[model samples]
Target: MDAHSAPLPAAAMPANGFGRFAGHLDRALGGLVETVAALLVVVEIVILGAGVMARYVFHAPLVWSDELASILFLWLSMLGAVVALRRGEHMRMTGLVSRVSPQTRALLEAVAITASIAFL
Candidate 1:
């Protein structure tokens, strides 16, 4: 509080309470989904590989391999949707939208979020 005291840098300031908690939840959820996806992919690959090797070497293919792989693929794809949200890698026409007013931007964002949620 002294006049001569050096000001703290922005990074040294305490994080916004809500923002910090939101970030923590986001990271935790992302990590959990990532782990599940990884495990699913690994399991599918191992099972499919084993099936292929067995079929080639012994002329025996497990009937369940294809079904198992398909189920895993579907589940993985669904879980993978959150990855795009987390990465902020979605495609958008920024050039056109950048010139819009803040109110319009907020409206567009709300509409987009609504549409995305409805679609899912």
Candidate 2:
């Protein structure tokens, strides 16, 4: 399956306006982060290209060439994580929880989220 086709567990059916808007906001954030990350990738590529040209042709690499590349990659990864979380794209283990009643499911979800945060 493609990246966008990955399935997500049905969470508490969002009924209220706040819930719906929150979902919308999440999707918007995901899109925005993806756009920004793509632009950053282009910038990284250009800089890396310049580094390669200078290193081969001029025989002098910039002092901070490797460090800059690492920082750009790190930024892309962190932004990608935010995008994944917003899209519910993280690997979620919800098999057993799917069989439970809504209330119990919510409780378990809360507990799991808390544990995840604590672990992080």
Candidate 3:
């Protein structure tokens, strides 16, 4: 299945005024980040390919490509992290907790989140 078919995270659920606005904001930011990350992948590939050709085929190295690629890669990874978190893909604990009672689920979710943060 395509990534677009995946279910949305809890943050995107319906809510009151402020919460609804927050959800929209979160989704908008996620889309923007995802778009930029996709674009960066294309750009990094083009830059690296050109750099390779310049260094080998033409006997001239593109010194700036390495640094540029590194910075873009860092940004891509950070954006990916943000998207993963927004989509609740940061942990598998939720899937297991979902079968339990609400109270127990809440407690487990909190513990899992805290543990994840501590690990980070």
Candidate 4:
């Protein structure tokens, strides 16, 4: 068969052992991150809305709402970052990287990944 039409070898398929378990774990973690991030955003919105209503309608501002909302927002942002990283959607210099050769691009990507891990 032509190279372009050839079927992939058995080895090219997904793993059937520990690799499969790892894939499941990765998917579970990703789902958890997305759920937590979405929940935090909802909480932040509700808290802020409550605070606004308390101040204007009830004439009683929620003293703790701002602090709680800020904390939730921080958590939401961190979780969102995790989700973005997992989805390969985190911010990067893609415009510059796209101009480089494949080898250089790979090296740059490795360096970026290492730096990200170190920063984390």
Most accurate candidate by lDDT: 4
What's the true lDDT of residue 6 in model 4? 40
Residue 42 in model 4: lDDT: 85
Q: What does candidate 2's lDDT look like per residue over 1-120, in tens digits?
A: 322324554475476998889878877877888999999899899889888988999999876777898899999988877677655565555677667787887787688679868976
Taking all chains together, each candidate's TM-score versus the true structure is 0.67, 0.62, 0.67, 0.86
Model 1 over residues 1-72: C-alpha lDDT tens digits? Answer: 221123445587559998678768877998999899899989999989988988888798888888988999
Candidate No. with top TM-score: 4
Pairs with steric clashes in candidate 2: none
Model 4 regions more than 4 Å off: 1-14
Clashes of each: 0, 0, 0, 0
RMSD of 4: 5.9
lDDT of 2 at 12: 53
lDDT string for model 4 (67-112, tens) is 9999898888888888877767778787788788878878887998
Cα error of candidate 2 at position 50, Å: 0.9
lDDT of 4: 0.82
RMSD of 1: 9.1
The deviation in Å at residue 119 for candidate 4 is 1.3
Worst 10 residues of 1 by lDDT: 1-10
Please, what are the lDDT tens digits per residue for candidate 3 over residues 1-120? 223225767777776888889878877888998899899999999999999999999999999999999999998888887777667675465456657787886777687779868976
